[model samples]
Target: MSAPAVGKRQDRSGPGTSRLLAVHLRIADVLLRLVQLHALWLGWTLRGGLVLGVFPATAAVAAIARRDALGRTAEGSWGELRRDFARHWRGQFRHANALGWILAAAGALILIEERVMRAAGDGAIGVFVAGVLWMLGAGVAALGVLVWPLAAHFDARPLAVIRGAVVLLLGRPLAALAPLGAAAALAAAYYLVPGLIPAFGVAGPLWLVTAVLLRGGALPAAPAAAPEPR
Candidate 1:
């Protein structure tokens, strides 16, 4: 009787341990996903125009937002980050809002261009141009949202934002493409099976990484300049 009971106890214990481990992993994964989602959304939401004039400040604020989302302290160099944001905040905010107008116009143009191009029978070239314009609109809108917290924290000037936008456009095309592709793919997938509404929850983080990388700052550190002869 004792041996039979002992074996039953061991068998039950194995499943219990497995269940505990599985639950812990699910919880951990949820937490990590939450963190990444927030960070990525912050990056995606940052508008190109707003982020343009205030990249450094926006980056700092986005970092803080990421920390908050993760339930972590803004530790280690946080003070410096705050100060850096403060240095250019007022101007950044002004320009950030101003850039909103540009985004709106771009969106309108993308719509009109696509419609006109398709109607005019411009062929593949027209479709390509329409797609490009649409992409630009996406880039602008996504950047704004991704960098919102940063804009709120470290507003900057218009020219500055333009400079940043140019760098992103000319230098890091793939970064910009990632969020757009993700958004398109997600939308397509959602349409294919409307039952998967839960998947949209992941959109935030996907956009964030894309937005940041597109803005041309997330690359590995550049080599230090060679020193001149003493």
Candidate 2:
């Protein structure tokens, strides 16, 4: 029906796969709401619409994987998008528990960045605004940081993942500047969500995932052998 009415109409007075499904569905819904609320704030300040906006992109990739795993995106075009979104939403609970530390650490780093930028006489409004956008861009681009193992976790190739992971990781310092640049684009979102959005963006968790994925060359294919016995 509508965003607010989604979980409202469901009766919790039942038990079965339907109930589990309902729980998952609700979890997914809440996750999106969180992302939205978070993004809105960052959007105001940073102007890039927070890391959650990147959800559209991340969800796009994840949907493809889920579609492959479950066989067919039979839910029609719109239905497919909604279904994948719900699944991705529900999946964040895992991140909530496990990835919280990473996010917290990232927050500390951002604050440090904030103080440094602010002290440099970059103009309070300008630096604050710029810093927020930087966080948002960094969070999502950081997601790209994990693209290597993410592809692998979904059974991507070895050489490809290695090459891509290196590119993303090495490129991180440079790529991070976009979010920093986006700050000048807008500051309205930051005001709304405060630290929830771009302030406490997704960079930390993404970095975690990227590191894990790249460490062992976790791509689906076996890493190439030591060029055999010559």
Candidate 3:
């Protein structure tokens, strides 16, 4: 009889050892996902070539992460990651960047107002400016939390995504706010360890939003995939 092929090895370990190996692999998968997510986010943010591709790139990763979390998609290998990124980057590029620019412009306006309010200092006008600033800031934050998830799971115009996020936040304040708070905490962690952004920063926020929204029934059962980063 021919000898067993050298490359066709079979496991001879006991059942307990196989189970232990499975657990170790699961842990490694989780770690790898985090690292991949961070790298995706960091690469797009830094080297987003032409038309500010970071926005769509980040949104694509969020979509992939959501699918993986829900078991709709498999745990991604590097090739899978690349394919998903390319698919989403092409599909979502225009809409994602459009929304991003709009948000950036709004934020810039708010910052200018904030500076003006500080210059005015201590009066009725100051109080009004502060209040306006607070409202605007909160509005932006609320929108930020919902937009990317909407992009991942819906088929709609960019304006519709914005509108839907507003409606969802208003209708389900408690559910939305909890995840938002978690996202904030994760962001704080990233700030303290900026180095981790290239290996884990984006995963925490993406996972929190995707998992919470799915659990809370904030998202539809079937994802539509209309269009951005959260």
Candidate 4:
């Protein structure tokens, strides 16, 4: 009753069916949170918040995923969501920009290489560039699913977070594909019904990626608390 007194810690290991139910419940919560995040992203984006606000908003979504994974959040808690979003947005602003620049640069290189390959129209260098572009795209996908969660869950330098994500991907290539596969599916769904984004855009993909990372033990488990004074 009363939602377990809000912050009272409980055993995380539940029965198999309970765990399955919880997963489903979490997905429902994520869909709600996704609407909130998409609204924030849209509001900020409309104000020319592209470079300045995108990462912070994205970080907020990642923060929600992290908090929910740790069992520190409750459903229908808008105040908590706002607080978490603001905290993550401020803490991650600079790092988000750093990541944005890196991704932007990679995208530019891919476009430039594509143009060169088009102009060359079949050559060894063209083929090589195409391969490089493919690899870069793959790397970007890995970075997207890993980096924000890394930032949300750890207190590390931005570059360190990037390196850790890369290391994790290299060490567990198959597991790493979870996020990329989720991304591709989400992208396809969005392409098919562009309206789906307004309804369940980032949250769907974020939850999918976060679920994968949690399963892989990429995030540290929340520590159990000491017993309250009796």
**lDDT ranking from best candidate downward:** 3, 4, 1, 2
lDDT of each: 0.50, 0.42, 0.74, 0.70
Worst-scoring 10-residue span by lDDT in model 2: 221-230
- By TM-score, rank the candidates, best first: 3, 4, 1, 2
Clashes of each: 21, 14, 2, 0
lDDT of 2 by residue, 149-184 (tens): 344244333345334545654566444334333432
Q: Candidate 3 — which pairs collide?
A: 151-227, 154-226
Quote the positional error of residue 82 for candidate 4 in Å.
2.2
**lDDT of model 1 at position 16:** 96
- Candidates 3 and 4 compared: the better one by TM-score is 3
- Report lDDT (Cα) of residue 177, candidate 1: 58
Candidate 4 C-alpha lDDT tens digits along 18-120: 9899999967766767787777656544443676877766766777777666666655666666665666677667777787567667777777877778788
Task: Report how far off residue 214 is in candidate 3 (Å).
Answer: 1.3
Model 4 residue 113 distance off true place after TM-score fit, in angstroms:
2.3
